[model samples]
Target: MAAGAGALAPVPGVPSASLHEFPYPPQTRPRVSGGSPAGGVPPATDLVLGATAGCLACVLTNPLEVVKTRLQLQGELQPPGTYPRPYRGVLRALGAVCRADGLRGLQKGLAASLLYQGLMNGVRFYCYSHAEDAGWTRYPGGTVAAGAIAGAVGAFVGSPAYLVKTHLQAQTLSSVAVGHQHNHESISGAFESIYRQHGVAGLWRGVTGAVPRVAVGSAAQLATFASAKDWVCEHQWFREGSWAAVLAGGMVSGVAVAVTMTPFDVVSTRLYNQPVDADGTGKLYRGFLDCVLQISSKEGLLGLYKGIGAVYLRLGPHTVLSLFFWDELRKMVQHQQPPGP
Candidate 1:
């Protein structure tokens, strides 16, 4: 797969080929150099690159994240049409946040967000890239499995940060507040409070919801991204190595990821931000499955899709920026390495 020639245009009147027949455009292939298989990055460097990119993206898109979280939790546990929705849409939610908490409101939980994104994507990219370097992704279905596993590991490692982030983001003023507000003063305060109340186990209280959200999201995002890139190149939509192709592929992948990920995302946010009993058990949800069942039965199926627009708005750009930055950084590092004999 790495030894491919330049992009091969589909033959006139011929059907597009499968990824099995063509894994990547030549320019997109990792060039083997020195002792690095497929010009792969060092494991530590891959982690840094992924974390750096994810954090950068997180900083820019966190406002949408704030809005999305609030939107998801706006009418929590209420039947449709039963509750007055304070945040009816993305724009309305943004306005409500600004009015209630000022511009800084949009940046709530930034510290926890950065921590989560750093750990999660760092581990995620590290694992996925290493799998590719090992040729484990050459097998059919390997890419999806590798992406899912990487996401699960990353999500678990960062679950504590995410738990704190959810609570912080959901901490709005009474007028615009939604969900079970934790009233966290800051990331450190949230962490300290949870640890004090429930011990070490409290920090990971919502990981059950987080794992599937990230795993499904990662699989959809990565799989679609690779296939979309190949499809764009095969269709001659952009020149090899063109930034346009990368952007196009990212945009396509973002839609797939948003559709597959939103339900899980909504559930994860609810789980993390739900109030807890003294024993550290969730007050509202016993576990992930119970949460799903309650949300479905009480709020209807669309409850799981709340804040979908905000989710897409945030996720699409986040996906594009993170992947683009990660890809460019990898290329830059690969170029710096000396070639093999």
Candidate 2:
């Protein structure tokens, strides 16, 4: 789970008392043949591992990501639950997209999605692992704040990729002309066009919104994953270090992430994709709070939770795969290292 800036308020229902326990055996920290300044394995190991896991998961669920983006951006100004809106819900939205543009429509932003995930999670996991190794995440209390800081750093770096991804996903001819379908045909082209049009600042269009979204998501995900896995191990729910424990912990994390992230995710998508005039003022949302207020008033509370199904589908398996892979990689690293002096 995400780990150590400020105290992360306890996740409701998880006992605070036992959250400090580490699930894995505590071996003495060892020196490395090639390592970071810390004398242990370089934190870049986590970066590479996270990117591997993120890119792999992105390929599998890009369709869901595309669909989820569309769902969030769809019907923004339209009345809640209204038909004649291009997309209404999961099944209807999926059918509408396929019928209009074919299955390729759902894959609209796959490239950007993969690139963004690699950039974002690479930094995210790298930062979190460092904090964990330093014992910042020795307890659950600091997990969320730690994740927020790491998430913000990663989001800032990857904002352009995410902006491109959202623009591609939000494209539909019917409604939401307020949101643009970019003319660029490739990822590089998209990046170039945005830079040429808006300069360096243009590429980071929604970073303000993205930072909180990712921070909350990372914290909710990693903290719960670590705690749940530890709890499962303590009770012998599954053999320690087994996939079963990993999967169980990941599942718990998915729910927390979904609940914490959807609102901020919506804000990030809108801020990123909303069309701006030559002067760069958003036509749809005045700002993040305005977007939430408008959505809440017009679409009701459920508006905040749009695309939740697609979120769960994408995030659940993603959390499972990434955590499982990261855990296994760490175990392998520990295994290969000689005993600490």
Candidate 3:
């Protein structure tokens, strides 16, 4: 049976001759490079490149993330229409944050944000890069699994940074800045404070929430990007590896990620930002299930989708910038590699 199945299996390295043969084009089709290497490992250089690009993109979009976090956290567990949401809409929320917290407030967690992005995306893109090269992305389900594993591992490793980033971003800095404002002055300070207050465990407060959010988001992101790129190239929509193809792919990936991941992202923000009680338990949310239940019961079903627009806004540009950089950088490195035997 195994041999029979193998005999019928499609050759992953072959590109479809026409649209009728394959539902979508694969940018350049699978290559000899897609064959399994002895170690099945991607280069360390790709990981570093992914991290660097992610850090740059995170810095560019931190303010939007802050706004999104604030909006998501505003009416948690409150009944719909009863919560006193300070920020009205996306534009209003942006303006309100600036008005209350000042322009700098928008970029509250730059350090933590960069740190999380570096770690999270480093692992994510690294894993996807390997998966792509290994021909795992040739199948839709394989792509999601590869992305999910990568995202889960990355989110777990980067949980502490993510916890800090959420905390710093959620704080609504009062104009007065008086009476012990929640100011995360530095990453070290944040780490030290959380450790002293909640012990070592506190640092990774909402890893459970983060894992699914990132995993689902990453899966959607990588799969959609690949498909979009393939579709564009198959139809001659854009030159392979060109900025145009990258941009189009990123746009589709960003929307798919935002739509699929928003609810989990909302939960993650809430769990991370919610005040920890004396027993080291979340005051507003007991756990992932509890949070979901409370939000549904009190805030209505839409509560799960709060700030979706804000999520899309941030995710779109972030996906574009990071993928653009990664693709361009990878192409450069590939060009520089010596010819193989």
Per-residue C-alpha lDDT of model 2 across residues 1-341, encoded as one tens digit per residue: 11111112234345544443222212223434454423334568768867766777677667777778888876676676574466666778788778776889878878888788888878876786666557665454555666678888878778899999888776765543224566667788889888887888889887778888887887676566666666777888887666677666666666777788888887788888887777666787878788889888887888888887777667766766655555566667656766543
lDDT winner between 2 and 3, please give it: 2
Give per-residue lDDT, candidate 1, residue 63.
91
Worst 10 residues of 3 by lDDT: 1-10
- Relative to the unseen true structure, what is the C-alpha lDDT of residue 246 in candidate 3, on a scale of 0 to 100? 53
TM, every model: 0.86, 0.81, 0.80
Give the per-residue lDDT of model 1 (tens digit) for 43-131. Answer: 67878988887888888889998888899998899999988788879998889899888999999988999999999888887787677
What does candidate 2 score on TM?
Answer: 0.81
Residue-level lDDT of model 3, residues 153-172, one tens digit each, is 87887899888887777766
- CA lDDT of 267 in candidate 2? 79
- Per-model C-alpha lDDT, please? 0.75, 0.68, 0.67
Evaluated at residue 162, the lDDT of candidate 2 is 92
- Output the better candidate (2/3) by TM-score: 2
